[model samples]
Target chain A: MSPLQTTWHHIRRSPFQSLIATTAMFLSFFFISTFIIINSGLSTVLKYFETKPEITLFLKDGLDTATVENLQKDLSSYQGIKEITFISKEKALTIYKEQNKNNPLLTEMVTASILPASFEITVSEPEVLEKIYQNYSTKTNVIDEIIYQKDIITSLLNWTNATRQVGFAIILIIASISFLTMITIIGMKITNRKDEIKISRLLGASSFYVKKPFLLEGIIYGLFGSIFGFLFSFLLALIFQKSINSFFQPITFIDLNVNFYLILLFAEIITGTLLGFIASWIGAKRYIKF
Target chain B: MKIVFDQVDKKFGIVYALKDISFEIDQGEFVFLIGNSGAGKSTLLKLILNQLKPTSGKILLGDIDLSNGNKDDVNNTRRKIGVVFQDYQLISDKTIEENIALILDIVNYPKEKIQSRIDKVIKEVNLGTRRFLFPSQLAGGELQRASLARALAIEPEVILADEPTGNLDPENSWNLVKLLKDINKENNTTIIMTTHNNEIVESMGKRVIKINDGEIVKDYNISKKS
Candidate 1:
């Protein structure tokens, strides 16, 4: 018989045994892809946070309009300066008023003239923000202290990196466990077929001839497992997309990229094939002599 | 062509199963091996099939030394030998037709030829009515007959029946023996039947080789007229 035909026959002979191993492998891939999506989402959020202007220098009470213009020009030419935007006190007051409009008490406390003139400073990289602050702090004309949300950014980076590490570790552990489980199941099934295999060999069957059916069964398992895994991951991503959009709507964090889907599909296929091959190989190796 | 064992010795660890056994079966002869349980009848057959390797001496199948035969030679040897056992050994899940076709399938017989071959073998074995039945669905004699039909389907040079009638009733046993004799006469297929049935040995009136404690104690040929 052809290898494919033999494999189909073996699979039909034991449907439940094949299904259990494939389903376990499918879940492993699904969990792994879900972890990948979450990590990708967090990294995108961190990248968005990095792009916002970090330091804002508020000017003192009576600097002239020409002095402010000269300050903006000098800051623009400074090293480590990616961007320099002069936010006039009036424009800053308008933005703040719009933001706090719902809080009537806060709205009454802020006015165009009362707000300080500021130069919004964005550094090339946040790691060198301390040096940028020190350089700007030494300048006499730059009146008020630098305003930067360092603690919030640092904590976000830490949490995201930690999540990435922990998520990957957990995925690895689960994959390993599921792989072993599938192997055990396949091994048991192979053991049950010991009599049939013996009869085949004694009847003049080759090793390749005996193993063809089993390898075919493994391939079938892989195809079905990967399909189920992909469906599961896709459904999960769809469910999570709404929550992600609601949470990070201000930042462009929810990326529904087609490339990511393709990568996830590839991961599922790889997982399915490896799981099936390893399980069948180990099982067959134990029972099939030569 | 004839098969011969030349001073063959088989040992498992320290115990000898068949020691210094020498015998020959001429082409187209129906022979019976008679002994108590564990008298090395099965082991002798196994040596012929290369299922068990003899520790010393040689087994010749028409001058090919099977004692030192490697896997390729062993497999080639099995192609010409059809074996049936006391237990049916038919795959329980498959139909009687599938069981008969299995050996042919393994040997890569043409797909078009398999159906006709199965039909012919089942009809020859008088199992045409139950060709579609599974092993579990058949009685002991019918299962044994199905197994024999499967063995015969390959059209082998040698038919090895190991206690072929062990599980059958007297009537079934007689029918099976008659069937084997008929197949032997029609095809000139060399039949080596191992059995404890002395009545069968005498009734066949052919050749009988008796084994006691792994040694062949008696060899006799009976004329057909008697």
Candidate 2:
């Protein structure tokens, strides 16, 4: 019989053992893939927020066009400033009217003279946001008020970092457990077939010949585990895509395409297979005597 | 291929499992290794199989020195010899045919010839009808025969039957012995059978090497004596 055929025979003979091994691997890979998806989504949301206008500097009520133009030029010359847009009072009033278009009373009440003109500044990095805010906050002569979502951005960053650290710890713990479970399962199988191994050796079988089936068996378990794990995560993502998108409104947080998922699946499969190979190698080496 | 043991001594810690054992069996020779329990017959077989390295002296299978050979050399030596154990060590999960096929597969036998070869050996052991049966489904005698068929599947230069009939009834034992003799005559395959059964030994009139306390007590040909 071929090594594959032998492995299949062994799995068939011990379905419960195979299932236990596959299940352990499945749980580990499931958590790993879920963590990846969630972390990716969080990163997407953070990126969307980071790229938005970081600081909005509202000007003094009677600032002239030249004064606003000078402010725009000054902001443009600042380091880490990606873009600086001068929103005139008329433009601000137009935005207000558009935002409240459903309510005629709200739109009719807004006028260009009442609306404050502002400079909407986009920074290249989150680190630069606080610096710009500090520099403009003291300029009350030309600036009426400075608005920047520094606290929200800081909190979002902290949450993403925490999720990554905790997710990584969980994956490491579960992966180690999964690896040990595989070794124990394969070791038990070897122990049960101790006599058969001895007989095969006595019959002139090589060590490779005796070990190949076990390694293949481990690979099979890992392959199935990773494939099923990927499928489960994919299905969950599909089911919750709309909710997740709405939760992070306008961000398109979970917009992964089929190609991206295929790549992730491939990576998970490789990891799972490598884990199985190493675990089985250790198990076979530890137990089987030539 | 011939097997030669030149003053081989196997020591496990302070005790000697075999001491200063020397013998040579020519190609195609049929020899009975007669010894009582704990007489080191198993140790001698292990030495020939290269399962245990000799503490001192040498063992040679053909030109390969088993005493100091590497793993590849040991495997190469083992490939030339087929072993049948007293327990009829057939894999319990596999059928008789699969058990035979497994050995053939291990030897890297021609893939196309494997099925035909398995059939020939199963037929030789008179297990053609029971080839599809697992070891658990077979009787003791049939299990031993399946083991024999597996041994034959390798087409080995030497066949080592280590107390193969130990668990069988007298009739089964005689039948297995007769089968071994016929195989020996037909293929001219070197046969080394270890047994404590004096009746089989006396009836066969073959060469006998009697071991006692890890030493060779007697070596003679019964046919010549008669």
Candidate 3:
């Protein structure tokens, strides 16, 4: 029989052993894919929030248009201002009404006079948003209340950074476990077929020929393992898409694109193949000598 | 292929297995390596097969220095040499035909010619009727013939048998030796076999190399087979 057929024969003969190794690979891959899903979703939300206006200052209702223009000019002179725009009473009222149109109770009494005009500022650096707000809100007579999103942006960014680290850490731990487990499982496989390997060597088979079946078996383990893992995570995402969406702001939901799936599949297969190859090589090294 | 050993020394840990051992077997010669247990008979076979390298000397297979050969070169050398083991070492799961086919395929023999080649070896070893049987279903004598068929299928220049008749009865052992002698004479193939069977050693009367305590104390030619 051909070497590939021999590989199949070995895998076919040992169902439970193959299952255990593949399952080890499957579980690890599934965990990594799940991490990727949550991480991507959170990253998308954080990116959305990151682009919104960083700081908003509500001026006193009686402030004249010229006073608002002067507040804008003062904000412009600050070091990190990207853009500063003064929202007039009419625009602020229109926006407030638009935001509360479904809640007539909240909007029925609101009018231009009641709604304070504000300065909407976009900063080049997020850190400067707090600095600009602290300096202008406390000292200016024109400012009635400050509605800066500094805290929200800071915490969101922190959460993003922290989750990214956590995802990386988890992947690291999972990869280590997969590598060790692969070595062990492949080692056992080598031991099981030790006699065949010796016979092959005695027949003047090349070293690669002797090791090929087990290596292919390793690759098969990794390949099927990762494929199953990817499917598991995808199914979980589909089942819990709404629940996952609830964790983010109501404005945006997770978009599962074909491109993302394709990329994930490509990445996972490469990882599985590499792990299988390396682990199989190491394991076969010990027993192929016979 | 002619086999030559020049001042070979093999040590496992601190103990020597074969020390200052040197010998030569001309092409197509049938030689028996006879020694008691721990007499370095197996070590001598391992050295000839290049499975274990000599610590301080050289083994040459037809002018190819095996001690300095690379891994790939070693495989190339082994391809020209066939080895048979005491336990018959046939793959238990495979049929007798498949066991021979395994080696033929490994050496990348021509696809259309593999069947013919296997048939020829089976006929030579008188295993044609048992080709479809697995090793476990065969008797001790049949298994040895199947193993011989596998070794001959490769059409190797040298056949190294490590106690080929170790488990056989006198009739079976004599049959196995006669087969080796015929193959050696007909194909002009070099045969180096290690054995402790004094009856066959004295009766067959071919060339004999006797070893004791990691050294060859006797190398002689007896009267031809009667």
Candidate 4:
């Protein structure tokens, strides 16, 4: 019989054993793929917040043009400031009107004289916002009130880090469990086929030849497990895509296309195959003897 | 292929399984290794199979040193010989035909000729009709024949029957021995049969090497009938 036929025969003879092994592998890869999607979503949300304007400095009225230009240059020279956009009072009024365009009363009430000119500053890192706030908060002559969302950004970063750490720990535990499950199942198979192995060895079969079917069995379990796991994960992600997108409103955090999912599926297959190979190698090494 | 055991000694934790054993069987010779249980007959066969390394001496098969050869050498030596066990050792889940095919597959026999070879050996052992039956469905004698067919499928230079008839009835034992004798004469294959049945040994009138307590006590050949 061919190696594939032998592997299939072994699987057919003990279907319950094969099911248990494949199910264990499926659960592991499912969690792993889910974690990857969630982690990617979290990173997207973090990036959205990090790139937004964190600090907006309202300028004092009647400030000279040269002073404003010098202030712009000074802020530009700051180490971590990524961008500094000077919004005139007219531009601010225009922004307000555009934002409230649906309400005629609100649009009519806003004017250039009433709106404050501002400097919107974005930093490369969230921690840089604190330093800029501390250094520029004391400048009351050129700055009216400094507004920044330091607390919200800091909290978001902390939560993302915590979730990632916890998720990684869980994945590690699940991966280890999957590996052990494969080892135990394959080892049990070897034990059950002790007589067959002995007889084969006595018939002049090489060690590799005797173990070929078992190694192929392991690969089969891993390959099918990973494929099914990826399918389930993809289905779940599709089911929750709308909810996730609305939750992170305007960020499009979970806008994954079919190509991306296909890549993930490929990656999962490689991982599962590698895991199966190593586990089966260890199993065969521990049990198979001449 | 001839097998040579040169002053071989096998010790298991200071207890001698086989001690100072020296013997040589020429090519195509049929010899009976007669011994009781624990007389080191299995150990001697293991030495020939390269399953057990001699503690103090060398074993050579056709110039390949089994005692000190590499893994490939040992495997090559084993591939040149076939083994039959007392319990028939057929895989329970496979049919008799599959059991024979498995050996051919393991030896990397020509894929195109595998079916023909299986048919030839199965027919030789008179198991052609029962080729599709599993081991559990076959009677004791049939199982032994299936095992013998599996051994013959390899077309080995040597056939080692370790108590092949130990579980058979007297009539079945005689039949199996006759089959072995016919195979020996036809194929000129070396046959080493281990047995305690003195009646079969006396009636066969073939070469006999008797072992008692890990030592060779008797070596003789009876003249054949005209």
Candidate 5:
């Protein structure tokens, strides 16, 4: 019989041991896949926020349309400007009226002259926003106040960065636990088969011949456990689909996309296989030296 | 292949399993190692098998020195030798056919001829029609015969039987001895067996090496024909 067939027979002879090993792998893979998906989703949202304009440029009062156009033209030529959107006084008043529609008294007193016209500018890179303000905020007469969300943007980036670091650390820990668990389980199996191994070696079997089956057994455990974990997470996502979709804005709905599911499954299985194989290598090395 | 042991000593912590042992057996010779329990019979066999390194001596199989041999050299030496144990040592989960096939497989026998080899060896040991049976289904004699078949399947130059009949009836013991003798004569395979049974040792005596308390006391040819 092949090494694969023998490994399966060994597993079958001890059902409880096999179950515990499979479950250990299952939990680890499941947690890893979840972390990867959530991390991917949050990364998408943060990336969008980082590239969108957080700075609003209010135009000087009584500024002609030509001056506003020139200011818009000049901002586009800047090094980091990604987009420039112009809001005229009349249009600004319309937006103000729409925003205060629920408050009739507040809307009745608002006029075009009272509302300010502005140019909303976004940068290709968020960190260059300070440079943009220093270069043009006071240098241009057409510019009034160069308002920006330094506190909001910086804090958001920091939170996302911490989440990413913590998420990776947790995934790494799960993988380590999975690796250690595979070693312990395979070690127990080696002990159980100690006599068989001795006899095999005495019968002229090489060390590779004796250890191949255990290595294959570890890989099989990882493959099945990862697939199980992936499917389990899929079912969980399906059951909580509505709540997760509603948790963030519509832009983040892409987190639950079909493509992401498949990609996450592939990544998890590959990572699990590597972890299992290396763990088995370590276990086999320790015992098969005899 | 010839086996030579020169002043071999095997020690375990403060105890010596074998002390100042020296012996030689040529190809195709049948030698018996006779001693009481704990007389270092098994330890001597393990040294020949290269399972245990001697504390302060050298053993050579043909031109390959086993004392300081590399891992590959030890493995190659084992490939040229076959072993049968007292406990039968057959994997209980595997059928008789699988038990023998594994040895042939490890020896890198041609995959296409494995089944035929298994059939031939099983038949040689008089274990006909029992190849598909598990070890638990066989009697003590049958199990030992299966173990013998596994050893034979390797087609090794030397067959080391620690105690071929240690766990068998008188009838099975005689039958097994007869089988070993026939194979030795027909295939020119060296047979090194360790046993304490006086009747089995005296009946077909070829060369006898007696040990007591880890020392060789007698090395003589008591057989009348030799």
Candidate 6:
């Protein structure tokens, strides 16, 4: 038989042991990869929030058209500014009317003249929004109240960081359990083949030659298990894709990236191979006497 | 071409199994190791095979020192000496032909040569009809014949049979001894076996070496007349 076929024969002979060991490795690495992928996406989303525009400025009543135009030009070249948008008082009044139409009590109080012309201002970054607020809080007739949603920015960062920490901790715990489980399965296989190993040694086979089949078995277990785990995790990501899209609407949730998935695939195969090789090596080494 | 033990001492843990034992068997010699249980008969055989290192003293197969040789050299030496055990040691799951083929497989004989050699040895052992049967399916005599076929398949210069017929009935045992004698006569292969049976020993008409209390008590050449 070919070496690979021989390896499969041994693995096929003991299905239950192989399954349990492979499953442990699969779950450990799968959860770790999934947590990393999702948390990294969340971290990117948090970063995007921190860089988004925060404040808008409303011009004073009865301002000339040129003065409003001049304000846009002035803010465009100003320091600590990311972007500026000029909105006419009529457009502001229209937006105000449309928004408040559902609330009749507020619609009666709102009018075109009452609503001032405005320039929407976004600072260099969310962190600098407060700096911009401090810089222009007293600037004469340049702005009405400076408005930015700092609560959302702060909360996003805090949540992403917390989840990343928990993800890391869980990955570590699962890896340890999988390591122990794979090693145990290897030990059992060695015990079962105790006589065969002794006979091989007596036949003048080297320790390594005798250990080949067991080590190969472990590698195969890891490979098939990881591929299976990767498929399951991908399906899970797909099932949640729509909810993720709706919840983070303006900021699209990225599906698994092609490059990142390739890397994870390589990781799964290597992890499986190493786990099998190491566990079987350790187990076979103990029993395959020279 | 011959095995020689020069004042070998073998100890297992705190007990001395064989003490100051020395003997020589010439090339193509047919001999039997006769001793009671625990008389160091098996220990001497293991020493000659280099399976157990001598506690003190030397073992030589021809001119090569077994104790000082490296693993590769020991394996090369082993390839020249075919060994059979009392238990048959035939892997129960493998068929007779597969069991014989295993030795060539381990030694990495070319595939084409392995099949023909297995077929030749199977026929020589008169096990051609039972070649495809697994060890568990075969009777004790057939299993023993399979083991002999495996040992003979390698075509070694020396054949060491450790109680090859120990577990067999009289008819089967006699048949096995005759096969060994035939192989020795036809191929000039050195044959060494250990047995306690006096009737088989007397009928063989070969050299006999007896041991007692870890020492050689007797060594003699036997003839058919007496």
Q: Number of the top candidate by TM-score?
A: 2
Native-referenced DockQ of model 2: 0.74
Candidate 4 overall Cα lDDT vs. reference? Answer: 0.89
lDDT of 1 by residue, B1-226 (tens): 5899889888989988888899899889999988899999999988887888899988998767887777777777787788887887888777898777778888777889999999899998899889988899999999999989988988888999999999999999999999899989999999999998888888688898888888888888866545
As for model 1, its CA RMSD to the true structure in angstroms is: 4.3
The global Cα lDDT (0 to 1) of model 5 is 0.84
Query: On a 0 to 100 scale, what is the lDDT of residue A15 in model 5?
Result: 76
What is the TM-score (0 to 1) of chain A in model 3? 0.85
Compute the lDDT of residue A194 as modeled in candidate 6: 71
Query: What tens digits encode model 1's per-residue C-alpha lDDT throughout A129-247?
Result: 67756777877565776777575678999998898889888878977777677667666766777787777777777666777677667666776777787878778778777787667
Cα TM-score per model: 0.85, 0.90, 0.85, 0.88, 0.83, 0.85
| Candidate 6 C-alpha error for residue A208, in Å | 1.5
lDDT of 4 by residue, A40-144 (tens): 888888888777679999999999999999999988887888889999999998888776675799887677988889899988876778877887899998899
- Separately for all candidates shown, the number of backbone clashes (residues 3 or more apart, or on different chains) is 0, 0, 0, 0, 0, 0
In CAPRI terms, where does candidate 6 land? acceptable
- What is the DockQ score, from 0 to 1, of model 4? 0.70
Q: Write the per-residue lDDT of candidate 5 for residues B42-135, one digit (tens) a residue.
A: 9998898998999998899999999999878888889888888888889987899999888888889899999999989988998987889999
Tell me the tens digit of each residue's lDDT in model 6 across A79-146. Answer: 77777777787788787777556568978877777777777777765556676567567765766766
Candidate 6 per-residue lDDT over residues B26-135, each given as its tens digit: 88889999999899888888887788999998888988899787887777777777788888777665578876776776666788899899989999889988999988
- Clash-forming residue pairs, model 4: none
Error of 2 at B156 (Å): 1.4
Across B1-226, the per-residue lDDT of candidate 4 in tens digits comes to 8889899999999899888898899988999999889999988988898878899998989989887898888887888898888888899999999999999998899999999999999889888789999999999999999989998998889999999989999998999999999989999999999998988888888999999889888889977654
Preferred candidate (lDDT higher): 1 or 6: 1
TM-score of chain A of each: 0.77, 0.83, 0.85, 0.80, 0.74, 0.75
The DockQ figures for the candidates are: 0.55, 0.74, 0.68, 0.70, 0.59, 0.40
The alpha-carbon lDDT assigned to residue A96 of candidate 4 equals 84
Q: Candidate order by lDDT, highest to lowest? A: 4, 2, 3, 5, 1, 6
Error of 6 at B186 (Å): 3.0
Candidate 3 lDDT, A53-165, residue by residue in tens: 78888888687667777878888888888988778888988888886676799888877887778888888877788788778767667778887777787798898889889
Better candidate by TM-score, 3 or 4: 4
Model 5 per-residue lDDT tens digits across residues A90-117: 9998987886675799889888998789
Q: Give the runs in model 2 whose Cα sits over 4 Å from its true position.
A: A59-82, A89-116, A123-145, B224-226
